[model samples]
Target: MHELIVSPYMGRFVMVKPGRKEGGTMPAYLYRELAETAPTSPCPDWLVKAARQAWHTELEGRPLAPAVLVRDDPGLGYGRASWELNLGCNYDCEHCYLGIKDFAGLELPERVRVLHTLRDAGVLWLQLTGGEPMVDRLFTETYAAAYDLGMMLTVLSNGSRLFLPKVLDLLTERRPDRVTLSVYGATEESYDGLTRRKGAYRLFKKGLDAGHEAGLPLSLSMIVTRHNAHEVPMMRHIAERIGAPMEEYTNMVPTIYGGDETLPTQSAEHLRRRKPFTGCNAGHTFFHVNPFGRASICKVGRDPAVDLLAEGVEGLSRLGAIADSLLLRQGGCTGCGLQGTCGTCMPLVQLYRKAEAPLATYCQHREKEESV
Candidate 1:
């Protein structure tokens, strides 16, 4: 509220809001510290750096309390949609929620339609995701179209696909705002064991190397699980190796393509309990759209409650019903220490708490997933 919370990369320049400066810009020295301190969302240290700089400048400056502040207002946040571009991936991982299902049946024209539909919804920031975005049929085309339309695009990738001349060309054309790569095992055996595919570790590294040589802005992520939670430092080392920043996420329950409210099969059952992220309108503020026109407010929730995929763009604009469904932070959230500390998913904690760990699913068991 007083001192601007900024990324280490930025100094006090523009202050987006009057409140605490968590995700906004700061001096270059504070990026890592700010990334570790920010309450939610970890993309890249530079992402935080850029956001911090923008917040005080182009972004909405500080929230004003009306004499009688109404809840209907935009408040201190923003709305965004996460569209799973294609389910198919170049590699298969053991904890992959979509797994082989990402490659399921889907018409090519239909997939393209989804992009246009999302564009129509006035989505400012669009996320292209899936088993692996590089494997998508129209990935290059889609990127080109989105970039031309002035939509800020972010891609979730494994870093293995960027080496392809065509894919590399797409990156050159779009110059995407962000590319998040998930790394699980630091060693080939660990990464291959989790991915269930050998040589993927090498491929991911090759992609990271290529991206760096090409001067692509990048971010890295890691999911702390039973086998690799202790490997946080190693994961950080990997990020540093690629000249990117890193983030560590507490485990969460998987929504499995937002399939059903079921316990997460791979999450750690018993974790260090600190607090819970509840009462937040995850659906309204955060959105998850699956292939085949399926949609959910919270990316971690299995049941979308509403099917926007079938309903089309108009359905997505009516976000009121979805926002209202979010459970509010009652006692459990306010009383705990980890309340706003860790990156918490409200839909995930409320729905499933398995036998092994409190948080079931984690950044898909990858090192670079902490950004999620």
Candidate 2:
């Protein structure tokens, strides 16, 4: 396959590599011309110049062509997706939203079919996530398959497995757009205590060092919970030391199955006011898929999902309507004056309601909305 990908992003035409580490934009005329050119045709002078400028590489005669370009499909509207490879994880954190972490998923053959379906659905930006996606046996093979299919991939992990030789080698050779690792604590005492896995902190540090040394693109998600609230500053220092951008997450939500078990772990003092919900293009421009190939509008609003395996890409036709129905301010939120300033979305409100969590956790009607 060619090293570059030329496709339309949202409403604009652009050129990007499969890993998404480098790219630039091209005019609509060039984009249209490339689509009509033969795959084996000579790399035009303009494209060669643009490629050299973007990738900083010199092309040798006919090495690049129209085959590298991704054409738009009038039938498919979605552009991105996230797939939960498996719900299995080595570290069992008390605050994990996926309550029951089971080590179960589709085998390689079926998994390949799912990847193909995603590509056929016009999904270009894809995220591979799970309880811990790295723990899945077919993780590398699945990743390679998706990368080969021209999808810009991202992996969400806890960083405990980045020290593995096979995983490191695969990632170094075929880089992902980004590898987002979650940081639980700055010290072993708090990290291990929170994850309930001894040596978890050591493994996490080792993974971080290995990935950095290998020159992999890395980012951190600082998960602030009651167990590690005191170490927030230390966590920021660690991220700064590593030179990776870090984002802090203080709000704890109910499990995907609507269980209240995770709510007790929230750090009340760290809870921040959420921005008001405006809108999103969940089911229309992007969607989510479970390990079993069930497609949903998004992760939180998962009911009324489409079975990709049974109904194929055509099943996505129902998701737009599903999203519209779910986003309606019905249920307990109906006709509420606070609707204009509500920070939480409808589906998440439903989860909190199902868990019977305190109204202070999500609703704007709570007496003390400042803290959880």
Candidate 3:
């Protein structure tokens, strides 16, 4: 194995080895530096802004509920909840809509206020996701505060920045119960091919190793795409190597970039190989906050005219009525072979101008997989 040099810290960037490529063992000095300071550059600036928002709410004394999961009975544990904490990221990997160029940062406090509102409304399971949440400096204090509030905090990340010894220490100190890392590729070429970089595969792997060494509860998250879908085995290999849980989902939304082409395309074989899914429980369960603060029904819904934050949750529920319009209910859902047993693909409706069609590949490929 070739010796990999530790790369200097870029903005929230943790594993860009400098002197050598990352095919072999990591440099000893790099490990020492990581042990010293948690990577702080990748942290987003909006975290502070979110705190300010919480302060404003405190001053106003107006209590707002967050994504509340109303339980008729009980038995529910840490009901599902997630927040798209920001729109910034450290890489421009294919299959990511944010790979588009015009992405900007979200105001920090506004997000914090939203969290406060949601937590107050009974949200317990919290997921902070973005280009990458670990890079945001605000995560330092936010994780601490959330844990103090008795909220189970989780960070959805790319595993690029977590390699720094310091970053790993901070995560351990905060002790976030869960960190979901998206493993793009197992090898450097496959990972670089998707991320459009030459060495992202190594950086991601190194960071993940650091996170695991820190004794954090880590899970591997994957988006099944044609470009990297074939690498599913690779992702699984990673999960096995690290003892992390592995999960993969069909394309949630289509390519929605305004200008640049060069988007990812999944192969029929890959789409077929993907776990069969039917519809999405998005609006009925989860939702998204756009860069401008509009709370849309799904990640691809960027309708600024219907801003959920501005209108509030009530407004959000009302606006998503657009989702149920006569036109959306199309596609033969009745008597479908995979109806009750499969997950929803509802996000595709808004992402594509056309009505949601049956994922032919999904239906055909998994027609014979024995029920688990």
Query: All candidates' TM-scores?
Result: 0.64, 0.95, 0.62
Off by over 4 Å in 2: 65-75, 368-372
Worst 10 residues of 3 by lDDT: 64-73
Ranking by lDDT: 2, 1, 3
User: Which residue runs does candidate 1 get wrong by more than 4 Å?
Assistant: 1-79, 105-108, 250-252, 255-275, 302-310, 326-346, 349-372
lDDT of 3 by residue, 1-372 (tens): 101112212112122111112212224453343345333322123322332343221212221112111111112111335666556677787667655534454455665555554444334456777767666656565555554443556788888888776667766665665788987776777788877877778888888888887778898887666677667776788789878888876454445543223223554554434344544454444455554555555555444324535554445445435544422434554455655444444344334434233444224425445443
For 1-372, candidate 1 gives per-residue lDDT tens digits of 112222111123222222122333235334344334333333344433454565533222332211101111112233356777677886765456563445653465666566666555544467878868777776787677755543456888988888888987777655666788887768777776667678988998888888878777688878655555556678789888777877665443434544332234234543444453345555555567776557677555646455654777666655546556554433344454445544445554444332233332421223234656
Report how far residue 21 has shifted in candidate 1, in Å.
16
lDDT of each: 0.56, 0.87, 0.53
Candidate 3 lDDT (Cα, 0 to 1): 0.53
For residue 71, what is the lDDT in candidate 2?
A: 54
For every candidate structure, what is the RMSD over all alpha carbons to the true structure, in angstroms?
13.0, 2.2, 15.8
Q: After superposition, how far is residue 183 of candidate 3 from its true place, in Å?
A: 1.4
- TM-score head-to-head 1 vs 2, winner: 2
Local error of candidate 2 at 184, Å?
A: 0.4
